[model samples]
Target: DARRTPPAETEALLTEEGLGAEFVPARLGGRLTRADLLARALRPVFRRDVALGFGHGIISLFAAGAVWAQGDARQRQEMAGLLLGGGRATILHHELAHANAILRHEFTARQSPDGYRVGGRKDVIINARRAGLQVVYARTEPARGPRSHSVLLLDPARQDTAHLRHLPRVETSGMRGALFSGLEFTDCPVPADALVGSPGDGVGLALRAFQVNRSLICGVVTAAAGTVLHSAVRAATEDRAGPVARRWHKPLAGVFADLLACDAMATVVLRALSLLPASAHVLAAAVKYVVPDLLRENLEELATVLGARGHDHASPEYGALDKLVRDLPVAGLGHAGSASCQAVLVPQLRGLAERSWFVEQEPPPQLFAPRAELPDLDYSLLGIAGGGDFMAASLVASADRTAALRGPGAHLGALAGAFATELRTLREQCRRIPPGAAALNDPAVVRLSDRYARVAGAAAVLGTWEGQDGTDPFLTDPAWAVLALTRTGQRLNIPVPQLPDGVQDTVLGELLRRHREGRSCDLDALAYTP
Candidate 1:
């Protein structure tokens, strides 16, 4: 359906409503000053249509984020003008097979008297055919390392088309309607000013850009899962025979808690992009790796609630479920998939374990506050490794405080303590092992990375609960907190004894209540009308 209409058409409608400004920096005459706010503004679009969201806007954001983070004055102003005009822009970095591994990139921009001539090809690029500006990562020299590559802003409108050609659209299973194409450049010349940042800064800029891209993508995909939860809950609530509702109540409640826990992870990570940019790389990777895996599993479970209706295209409202299930995974693939994200973590575990994982510093309250004001995103501060994780450290401290208290919160506190203990054990093991790139590919390291992600999720949810100021009933309640921690523990294969009686009933009742009231099951403060 997305392919049936031109992406530019839908993009223009969103642009008319100022969606383009959502990706532009506030200083650049745009609305996007904070990552959390950007997610909030785009939530409705992603919820309604993933393809349109990607084709019309998000892919451009990926291209623009790099410039916003590393671009010179001229580059930023140029990008602002292009996006404000509703013109699509995209980043061409790694081939699909490479998954943003810059070392493997074959595209090159050789120096010339006139300027630089770009050569090679880029495929699986969204909006490539229509994008007015393509921010390309090309090898500028024969040398290796971070300095060898340079980022260039290619303006198709200004280029000589004598050798530049747009590759035919490539059809795919999901996001079928977006313009997924390639660009082949044969000595396409451009002015030297097209280079973004300085030569040799491209790799650093890209690594920093990944932190932003991975964080935003995690938030968008999580919102899509929120849409799925809404639809499933609607089906359960409107079940005519009452049997479906009864059968799905407990499962729905468990999944709802999982979504909340996952939402908390994404929420904290996005906020961290601003509050803790120096240490946000690992946190962002944890979010990218963990959140989508949870969503994929949750969607599969949701299929039971939708029954046969999930596959029935005739039921337009609910049938979008099939498309969403197909499309959500696509967002996880482009820049980095789960394996690549985990690969980033495996090597950093040693340093994090030694210095930061269980430290006692209190995270900024803004990280827990949804849509809270944040400091400017400084891309230069973002690193390959954050050296420490304040979220995990804070989680351990908060759980200790709760576990020390006498009362109903103690049980949940103990679960938190158990999670913290597991993390400590993981750190001990990771510290003793060789922290190398080769270790990242090891199965043992992969499993440990997975456990590390679950630990991060538990930490984020507990951190959110501890920071709540009692205004939100569901979030403030220990019941959901207990369920959230318990579910995360279950994911780690930790022992979770049978829940106390009425736990399921109470949680399920709240889930159905939220659904009936048209409220988001995630940490989002807004309610869903449909």
Candidate 2:
């Protein structure tokens, strides 16, 4: 884009390509890439403008797919022309009130055999007013479980116009100008064909979408973070001539460490991405789990160097940094919050869960990983088990999704049972940890271990089916809620109730026991060298 098109030409390119109806796939007139390239290209765009970059870049995914997924080829072609000829934008069916999943809130078409009116509102919908197309994910409780909800693509011109009001400024601390809108679909009419896929398949389809969204998020976050690191290092260096040089090396070291950490994370994300469909849910969740907090740490650290002026919009040099940091949260929180990403990740811990399906049991580690090595793993685990019960719940989620438990009621039941067992196992393990062996002294280890125990404890305190139907909630994403609790306890490392001494026998303990003592160790022991 930088080579052929002038910087100012971006908007014009959108017009030329008839991108207003972008969410439409090539089958519907838009030129979209396969998943891998799409994920990579998004990185640069995120640096420029997270919201718009995400909005325009993904319109094809959201808007186009919503319609093309549901409509017959002819219907898609007809809509395609309208877009190519220029003047159609599609409404992406996302309920900000929900986890951008398939649970819809408005139901105008249920009673009507072929025609329906959509009522209720969709908040934080991108391109709600501007698009000619609206792919709405209305909540239709279809017998519960995975496929309970469905996507319905609407041409707003045909829906109720009275309630179509643009949302207020509503600026967030992060993700500015993302063009978020609230749509009150009051009695909005919808022809039967507007539905994406089979009548009751919306939520399932959205699950696939979520997977894609998660992977794409990693790419974007990776690129933007790289920019931050580059800038920070430059700022730390360029003053070589100054007498303050004696202290300069320390700052350079921090910058270097941050850079190395970022590089390692980038490699981790790629390895995860390469794992693909089989690994998508967990690996993408892991990257989404760690990257944002990384940026937050770097940004906070960089700010100290730039001083109080880093926060000042008045300083041209620092303003960009401020904006990037402010925008950091969106990427950080979006692909599932860091916590949710972690929760999803807990069950996928390389060996712990692998034992359930594999022929061999993974060997328990004798020596622990170095401090830097622990962050991502622990963050992923800690976020998952906020109170200690997360692992149990994760076990449940795993069991519920298993082949034996695919039926809605059956899955929920299995999930519940597994969750119960998970809590028990963790509690027993927590009890085994010796006293004063660990602490939240390190963010990474605490997040993964001790905090996980706490989350397990909390889950015991709160049953899985306590308040809402396990299958009915979109906000059911187990991130933030779990993260807060897990992060707290992760650092604490106290054992949960039962089995042992109510202490957490952590990786940190093994690491310290060997490394600090200068004892010989295995392959993992060698990786911790500073």
Candidate 3:
């Protein structure tokens, strides 16, 4: 109804509500101590409106992430104050051809007697026109090398008006309210203080920030999918005993299981950001590459139940589903695409295979808890390389525990044994890959990365189920777990037996129960008015 209203006002409202503090560091008088907690708070906004969510503060968080990772104490303090004061920020890191490939960046910040003369154009930056501060990654050296690039924190207000320009907003199929525009800087002078970290550390800092951004993307995608799923359920159950409700039993139940699995992956990865910072980067990429894909698939399945209401903007109550479908795909292309994230995991596969992946000890149970208090995110501890896969190891451990079950849990035990065999297959495939940077582009390598991601997601689901410790009645049951594993196995192309009839009925029943109660199918346990 208010599509004509710009995102600027909505952003201001969120700021007035003190959401800006959520992006600032706790040391700077904010509550950004944990990524998962912040994600929980932001999920509702993304669920409501994708454009407003990104335009409001997610763009600022992207800019703040880089500064938080590489900026000095003074720089971090200044950014925190700016955000705390309700000012917006944006990051300029990609151009037309080299979108997010920092190594091939054409932007330059040449040294001058005054400071640095920045010249380059950044395309499709979110909140470009309204941002008070812009974090730009530019090459400081004439030579072509990774060390040549550096990050600069520029105050657009201070730039020369004659040399700085913001291109017109780029219209899109969705999220049209965003101020998407290109930024052109021609010999724009920036002070020495604008430089973030050392001249050669820009790429490293950006990669570290990607770890945080990717995991956050998983959370937002899960939330958006949850909103759509809720609408689908309402549409299906509006006539509780009608054919629509009866016809969607199995399909809707399967979709709910996929939602839960994706949520589990998002939760584990977000918690890993604080628990195992070094390994978190690899896991983050896997979460980024896998969870969005799963959510996309789940949304497509829900569309069958939703029918025309998914595309019709005139429908009361469920019209927002149309916009969400358009907005979710953009998350896949932003910051890093699926292929790029998979590339991040390729080079490290061999090491993970031989050293610690499937053989490692189980990760702490708290890592899978949806409402657990996590430690503060330490940017310095985020590393590009990973030595182990704790989540996958947890799956291996759970399979052993389930194998000893005697009663109804025996069904889950059989499924776990099958998944363990799949893990062994993943291990052998990883071992066959020759370790080298040149092999990153191999089709086989890409396929392996994709499979590895599904395996990781399966492990996350297993860990979450076990982590509940029979406290949550719904999660402790093995029916949903069986469905989650089956869905994962389907994605991995691993042949698993059909779900038992009893398990199927139980899983389907839970799906209907959650829908009628106005609760999300994801692990967050959030309740909303349907």
TM, every model = 0.94, 0.58, 0.93
**Model 3 stretches with alpha carbons more than 4 Å out:** 1-9, 95-106, 142-145, 240-244, 333-336, 370-372
**What is the C-alpha lDDT profile of model 1 across 260-329, one tens digit per residue?**
8877787788788788888888888888888778877888888988888887756756876788776765
* Order by lDDT, highest first: 3, 1, 2
Q: Which candidate comes out best when scored by lDDT?
A: 3
Q: Which of 2 and 3 is the better model by TM-score? A: 3
| lDDT (C-alpha, whole model) for all candidates | 0.77, 0.43, 0.77
Judged by lDDT against the true structure, how good is candidate 2? 0.43
- Shift in Å, residue 289, candidate 1: 0.3
Error of 3 at 480 (Å): 1.6
- Superposed model 1: Cα runs more than 4 Å off: 2-10, 95-105, 239-244, 333-336
For candidate 2, the per-residue lDDT at 60 reads 42
The alpha-carbon lDDT assigned to residue 502 of candidate 1 equals 66
lDDT, candidate 1, equals 0.77
